[model samples]
Target: MITVERLTKRYGPFTAVDDVSFEVKPGLVTGFLGPNGAGKTTAMRVMAGLTPATSGRATVLGKPYAALPNPGRHVGLLLDASAQHAGRTGREVLTLGAILMGVGKHRVDEMVELVGLTEKEANRRVRNYSLGMRQRLGIAHALLGDPEVLILDEPANGLDPAGIRWMRDLLRGYANEGGTVLLSSHLLNEIERVADEIIVIGHGKIVAQGTKDELLAGAGTYTRSTDDEALMAALAEASIVAQRTPTGGLQVEAEPIAVGRVALAHQIVLTELRGADSRGLEEMFLDLTAGAAREEVAA
Candidate 1:
């Protein structure tokens, strides 16, 4: 398990991670989510001991990561996929990692194949590998030690749809076999499909953290009626708050049954009524991180 308690990191006058706290339980995949500059990477770096925290602590398996013996064998980390040496081949990278982690050379081959890199591709220099191939190689290196816990940052950055699906299944299978995974990625849909729990960070602070079901339970109910305005008015009269969805549906802040009764009392014909969870993680993520989102502009 991974535990971060009130961790904070600062640079000069700027604070990157602010009093953040969260726990990643064993046998589960926890998705770390944040907009650009929200400190997700900084928090993960602290967990891996790459950066010293200004205050607080982060531990993996009940100990600071650096304190673990042959750390890679217990905690696998892939913070930056493209940080590999350009002079080395993909196979060379894993071989060196295996040596450092005191793992058998045979494990290198297993990981190379497991990540779907062709033998020919593995033999090519890292400089020649595409971003997607680099990601695969990075994943291979992370699993080289067969660690019980994996911390990966943006592992799906350059993967295609099929590759992403493969990654999802691989993480799921790893968790099923009792491995703990903390994955950070911009792919909300993929995270929704793979993660058992989610942590959302904004402005270096944890805005929300919970199991997928627990988070979605607060999404309330989605209702559509033949007369949306009438349904909206009725909901207001019942002291229930609601907002109009982009699709002209009312996102009622109440149970489906409650909304149904309100509509029935007003003799409004309902066309659809269900939990807003059907809207999925993207909507919830956007809502939680609202002003924290950074808009990108092409130079």
Candidate 2:
């Protein structure tokens, strides 16, 4: 399990992570999400001991990262896929990591294959690898130690649909085997599909964190009608808050029945009206991040 309690990080007067606290339980894939500057990366860095926390704590399996023996074997991290040496082959990178960790070359081959990199591909210098291949190489290096916990940032940044599916299944299997996985990514749809729990950060603080179902429960509807103005008027008269979405639809903060009634009363022709079938993560993320950005600007 990974525990973060009131973790904070700052650079001079600028706060990057502000009193963030959350737990990544064992046997779960936790998706970490936020906007461009939401401090998600900072918080993960603190947990991985890549960045020092100004205050509070981040621990894995009840101990801080620095205190763990052979930290690589306890926690696997893949923060940047492109940070490896360009001159070295993918297999060379993993082999060196394994050697330093006292692991044999056999494990290197195992990880290379596990991450879907064929021996031929792994033999090429990393400089020649595409972003997707780099990502795969990074995954191989991360799993080389067979760690019980994983902390990854944008691990699927350049993966194609099939590659993403492969990674999703791999992480799911790891979590099923009683491992803890915490990954930050901008891919909301992927996160929705794979994560057992989600943590949403905004600015420098956590605004929402919960299981997808818990967070999306009773989420409002996406409603639209042929007579947009009439529908809006009806909903407004009924004191139901409805906002126009960019795709020329109404996002109603009420159930389908309420929207249907409004449309019926106004004699409006309904084109679309649906419950919270969508992941709802995108909506919540935009709201949290927008609000935080506004606050930051105001500050």
Candidate 3:
């Protein structure tokens, strides 16, 4: 498991991460989300011991990351795919990582194939590989030691649609097999599909954090009836507040059953009834981080 407690990071006069706290539990994939300059990368860097937190702590498996023996064997991290030496081959990078982690050289081959890089691609120099291929190589290097935890930043940045699907499946399978994954990406849809829990950050602070269901549940129920005005009046009478959505649906403050009961009692014919979150993660993300985007633009 990964635990970050009241973590804060600052450079000069600017705070990049601010009193952030969250956990990435074992056997679960946690999505770390935020707009640009929101400190997602800074928080992850603290967790990996790449940057010292100005205050508080981040730990992996009950110990600070730097204190762990053969850290790569326990915590797989791929912060930057392009950080690899340009002079080395993809295979050479993994070989070096394996040696550092005290893993067998055979593990290198396994990871290379596991990440879908053919033998020829693996042998090519890092400078010659495309962005997508570099991402694959970076994933292989991270998994080379068979770590129990994976911390990746924008691992899908250069992937095609098929490659993204493959990555989604791979992370799901890894989590299913008891690995903990903390994934940071701009791909909100993929995170919705793969992550069990989500953490949203804005202005270096945690704006939201919870299981996918819990966060989305607050969006409330959405219902549309043949006679929305009549249904709205009925809901008010039942002490259930509701508002008309821009799409001509009722966004209720109550559960689906409560809304349905009100409609049924009023003899209203319901055409649609579901959680408002059915609009999907992208909508919810936009709602939650609405001002953050404007702030980024202004900065």
Candidate 4:
């Protein structure tokens, strides 16, 4: 487990991250989501002990990351795609990292293959690698030590659909085996698909944090299709808020069951009665981030 308790960071007059706090549990994929400049990278850097927080703390398995015995053996972090040495081949790079962490060369090859980078590509210079290949190489380095916790920032940035699916499955398996996974991404659809929980931040503060269901439950959008005039009459009588769309449909803001019951009494023929929260998560994220952005602009 990884715990972030009021983790804060500042640079001169600007606060990069402010009192950011969340916990990542084992056996679950926790997504770290936010807009650009929302301080996710700063927080992740602090958690990895690559950068110090100005106040508060981030702990890996109940101890400060730096204070852990062979911290590299307990936490694997891949922060950026451009972090590797250009002159070294992917294999050589991971081999050196493993050697420093007391991992053998055999283990290095295993991780490279696990990340889907063939031995031939691993033998090529990192500078010669494509963006996707380099991203995989970064993941390979992170897995070299077989750490219990993984922290990756935009690990899916350069991956194709197949590679992204492979990564999702790999991380899911890793968590299933009792590992902790923290991932940061801008891809909401992908995050919705893979994350068991999400921590959404904007302007250095958490705006939403919970399982997807919990977030959806708080929203007031649903889809209902029925005889239009009867549905309108029922909505008008109940004073329940609803709107007719340009596409000859009505979007309702009340409970689906309530809508259905009212429609039944009014003899409304139903064609579709599904919830329509297409941008539920997107709207939630924007609502949080946009407020912060406006505040920043005002300041």
lDDT of all predictions, in order shown?
0.87, 0.85, 0.86, 0.83
Alpha-carbon lDDT of model 1: 0.87
In order of listing, the candidates' clash counts read 0, 0, 0, 0
Residues 1-299 of candidate 4 have per-residue lDDT tens digits of 99999988888878878898899999999998877677888888888888888999999999988988987798888999777889999988898899899988899878987888887999999999998998899888888888999999989988999988988999999999999999998667777777888888887888889886776655554555557777877888998888887777787776678778878888888787766663567887777666645332211
The sequence of per-residue lDDT tens digits that candidate 1 reaches over residues 36-143 is: 677878888899998899999999999999999999899889888899899999999999998988888899889988998899999999999999999999888888
lDDT of 4 at 258: 74
Each candidate's root-mean-square deviation in Å?
3.4, 4.5, 2.9, 3.2
TM-score for each prediction?
0.88, 0.82, 0.89, 0.89
lDDT of 2 by residue, 87-202 (tens): 99998999889987788899998988788888899999999999999999888888888899999888888999999889899999999999999998766777877798989888
Alpha-carbon lDDT of model 2: 0.85
Off by over 4 Å in 1: 226-238, 260-270, 277-299
In candidate 2, the residue pairs with backbone N, CA or C atoms under 3 Å apart (3 or more residues apart, or in different chains) clash, namely none
Question: Between the candidate structures 2 and 4, which one is better when assessed by lDDT?
Answer: 2
Off by over 4 Å in 3: 278-299
Q: Which lDDT tens digits does candidate 3 get at residues 22-128? A: 99999998999877777888888889998899999999999999999989889999998998999999999999999999989999989988988899998999999
Candidate achieving the largest lDDT: 1
Error of 1 at 233 (Å): 5.5
The positional error of residue 261 in candidate 3, measured at the CA in angstroms, is: 1.8
